[model samples]
Target chain A: MKVSFFPGCSLEGTAREYGESIEAVCKSLDIELQELSDWSCCGASSAHSTNEFLSVALPARNLSIAERKGQDLVTPCAACFSRFKAAEKALTCESKVDVGIPFQGKINILHMLEFLCREEFSEDIEKKIKRPLKNLKAVSYYGCLLVRPPRVTDTEHWEDPQALDILISRLGGESVFWPYKTECCGGSLVLTRVDIIHRLNGRLLDMAREAEADCIVTACPLCQANLDTRQEEIGDKEGVSYDIPIFYFTELMGLAFGNKGVRKWLGRHLVDPRPLLESKGLI
Target chain B: MELIGDKNFRDVVVDAVGEEIFTCYQCYKCSAGCPVSFAMDMLPHQVIRSVLFNQKERVLSSRTIWVCAACETCTTRCPNEIEIAKVMDVLRQIQQESGKQAKEPKVPIFHKAFLDSIKKTGRVHELTMIRNYTQKSGELREKLKTGEWKNDVRLGMKMFLRGKLKVMPPKCGGVKEVKKIFEQAKEHKKA
Candidate 1:
């Protein structure tokens, strides 16, 4: 299967490993990922907060780029996916704000999880798992963007999304039932108000730890960064230890599929995930 | 509570978000579902209430709008189906247009830095973004006063070593188009 890809900004910077692992996984599955030509930033959290027209125009620009490629667009970042979908909805409904470009929304946009969860990819994904993660117990963290504001995102289960959990189970890992799966990770607030992210992420990590999950698996880069980097500080503030390692869902897939470069991507995590993988004998 | 009905202010917000602000009945479900409500000066429902009551200054100047993560929890949980996050977005725009700086100055600084990065290179260069944000926010002075600047420097260095922080900005072929989008959006805002 072939699709146009939009890496967004984070995929090039802090979330480079997510980009690598996603590409590696797609290659293994024999999927063709043609990056959208000249794609720009999607104006995620900040654009909408600052200006509504800029928010819609930014993503509309990228969507117009993808429309030229004539393929369904897929993005690994949940924030980028939400922005693209929201922009499409906005531009379709409202006519006043001219984007100054051709953005008629000709193509479909999907998040990596949504793409992978598709029926055609499901069998291929299952067939590619060489090393089933036998002893790993993962709490699939959907965070906020992947499934919220249901009308815009059209996510199957916004309140309690199960797509990540289903994927985890298919990879031969136990999906722990946790209430905080769809919780907010305080994205972008990490820059403005670390205190808010510290508190919000603290609650999320605490809930996952309470569920006795081995590690947290997520599809969003901000969620992984927040849960992984600030965990120690949150642990200190709450007078408890939260050493749970957070993994990109793609990283876990790379490991399960026994991809040779999975370790390279795993090494990029702020909180090393190798120890947990080693203890579980999944490495 | 001073009940000042500024319907003009309410209409601006409604028109900006393209949603009826009066539809909100203030069930507080949005406040209940908000993850960062604890840090907000005004709750999510109260933000809508302020808008409904046409308390323009109270709604726009509150730290609540700036602190919102745009997580959409409130938007998702609202029984009235008001996109409260979109309402918050419009409120932030109103705040910026009225020349009222964000109560949490760091929020606006970061947003400006991020958009500036995009405007220049069509993508956000993290190093450039951080440098621009810290400079704009006067965070360096604040950190130095607390003697935490060195630690902040160390974190940046650590990220650099990990190959997570890129020093060079990346440009795309659509830079011209991106600039045009920004210009068009600004024109729309003016209209």
Candidate 2:
């Protein structure tokens, strides 16, 4: 299957591993990824709040590019998926629709989680798992966007999305179904206000740690950066040791793919996923 | 600090954003946990409480709106699901409409630059976003204030040299559609 990929800003910089892992996993699954040519930032946390039209237009431009390519747009970043999906909803709202884009009715905006959850790929993902993620108790963190602001991702219940858990189970890992799965990881506050993130991320990490889960897995680059990079600081502020590892869903998928350059992408993690992957013999 | 004795304030707030405020029983959970509470004269819960009491000027001008990262911890943790994050957004709108003397705050300035990047180019080219944000913010006006300015200059020079970051944004095919969206947003604000 071929799809247009939208790697938002973070993936190009701090989260380059995510983009690398996507390519590695896609190659293993025989899925062709065509990045939207001349794509712009999805405006992430900024655009929607300051200038709503700017946010919609930013993602719409990419959507139109994908429409021109005549292929569904796929994004590995949950934040990008949410931004694009929000734009798609805003543009299609009957009250105020954009007559210019030529969006027939609905534009196909698929999240990587949604794309991987397809029935055909489920078994393929399962078949590709060379290393067993067995006994690796995991807590799948959905972090707001992939499910929230429900108008866009109507496929599942916004409050309790089981997509990530289902995918984890398919890969031979045990997923702990916790209430905080759909909560916010304090989006983008890691840089602007690191203190609040200390409490916000502190709670989630503490919850995951309490659940006896080995590591937290997420699909958003910002979430990964927050949960992974800020552990030491959060630990310092919160006065507790939270050395928990945060894994990108694609990095785990890379292990399942066992494809070339898989370990290297996962290796770039600040919290070092190597120890966890090695214990499972996946690395 | 005293709760105003007016139902009109309560009614307007509830009407704008349904019963999310009453659930907040002054637990101070919002403030104690807020990362930006230190910067805010009014804590998260205090801001919501002010709005509940119709203390418009206090809530609108407080640093909370500008400082809030919109992390949603208070919203998620609020036994009320008051969505304090959404409330902050409403305060922003109210402030915008009231012409409450508030600029986009320091953090929000970066956010504006990012939004402007999308407004100009269909996509965000980081190099451009950084340059635009720094210049528009006048961060370069006093290089001494920012220790990172030297690093930014070096990175800018290196990125330009390697061509990793583009000098010009790649043209998106749907510039017309993008402009239409921008125009529509302005119309919505006017309406």
Candidate 3:
């Protein structure tokens, strides 16, 4: 399947492994990722927090670019997906805004997990799993964007999304049920309010342990950064050794696909997921 | 911003958002579902109530709107079908227009530095964005005062060692288009 890919800013910087792993897995599956040439930022939380018009217009610009491609647009970053959804809502709904761009909102936008979940890919996906992510108990965290605002995102099960869990099960891994699966991680507030991030992310880490999960898996770059990079600080502040690896869905897919670049991607993790994968004997 | 209505603050908000604000019957589901409500000075339900009562200044000055992560969990679970997150966004827009306040001051700085990075490079480079954020927020000095900057510096160095912090941004080909979008969107705000 060929699709327009928008590797938002995080993928190039902090989430480089996610970008690399997505490419590696897609190549193994014979799926072509035609990157949206010069796709700019989605305006994320910043634009909406300051200016609404700019927020919708920013993503509308990219949507316009992809609309011309006449292909379904896909982004791995949930933040970008949500931002594009916002633009789609504003440009196509009853309360449509004139974003000064020719955004028909005709292209169907999907997150990477959603793109992989298509029925046509499942048989091929099962055929591609060489490592069979056994002994990998994961909490498939959907975070905030992938499923929320039921009307805007049009997500059927917003409160209890099953997209990641479905993908994890198909990959030969066990997924744990947890209440904080869709909780907020104080995104972008990491630099502004570390205390808030500690409190919020600490709750998620503690809950993951309570659920007896091995690692927290997510598709959003901000959620992973907040959980992975800040795990140690939260552990120290709370006086407990909460050692957990936060994995991107793509990384685990690459691991299961037995793609060679999985290790290089895993090595970039702040929490270093190597020990977890090694302990599972899946590496 | 020249809201659609000028008679009352409630009308202004309803116009910016929708008529859903009137449908909110103080269910408190929004506040209950909010993950960060523990840190909010004004709860999500209370923010809506304040707006309904036309408490514009109080709603704008409170820390609840800024602390909100826009998770939309509240919006998803609202029994009244009110999109609370959109209301929060409108409140934030009005707050930005009314001039700066001291509640969660650093949050706006983060947004500014964030958008400025996108404006300059057509995408956000973490190192550059964070540098600009720290410079604007005086976060380093504040952390130095409390001796907590060590942790931040250590974390950044670790990210750098992992090669996650790139020294240069990618060559974005649509920077001019992005700038034009921003300019035209500003015009949209004006009209």
TM-scores across all candidates?
Answer: 0.96, 0.76, 0.97
The C-alpha stretches of model 3 lying farther than 4 A from their native spots are B1-7
Candidate 2 Cα misplacement greater than 4 A, ranges: A239-241, B1-56, B67-90, B93-104, B119-122, B125-188
- Count backbone overlaps in model 2: 4
Quote the lDDT for A182 in model 3. Answer: 84
* Tens-digit lDDT track of model 3 for A1-283: 7999999998888888989999998998899999998899999998998887889988988999999999999999989999999889889987688867888878999999888888999999999999888878899888898888767777888778898898899899998899987889988678887889999999999889999999999999999999999888888888997789999999999999899988888888889889888888998
Residue-level lDDT tens digits of model 2 in A158-248: 6678888887888778998677887677675544455667677888998898888999989888788788777766776768777788888
Against the unseen true structure, what C-alpha lDDT does each candidate score?
Answer: 0.85, 0.71, 0.87
- Candidate 3 CAPRI grade: high
Docking class of 2: acceptable
- Tens-place lDDT per residue, model 1, A54-156, is 8988998888878888899999988999999998887776554466667777789999989988999888998999999998999999988988888889886
RMSD of each: 2.3, 5.7, 1.9
Q: Which residue pairs in candidate 3 have backbone atoms (N, alpha carbon, C) closer than 3 angstroms, thus clashing? A: none
Q: Write the per-residue lDDT of candidate 1 for residues B60-128, one digit (tens) a residue.
A: 789999988899988888777787898998888767766667798899889999999899999988889
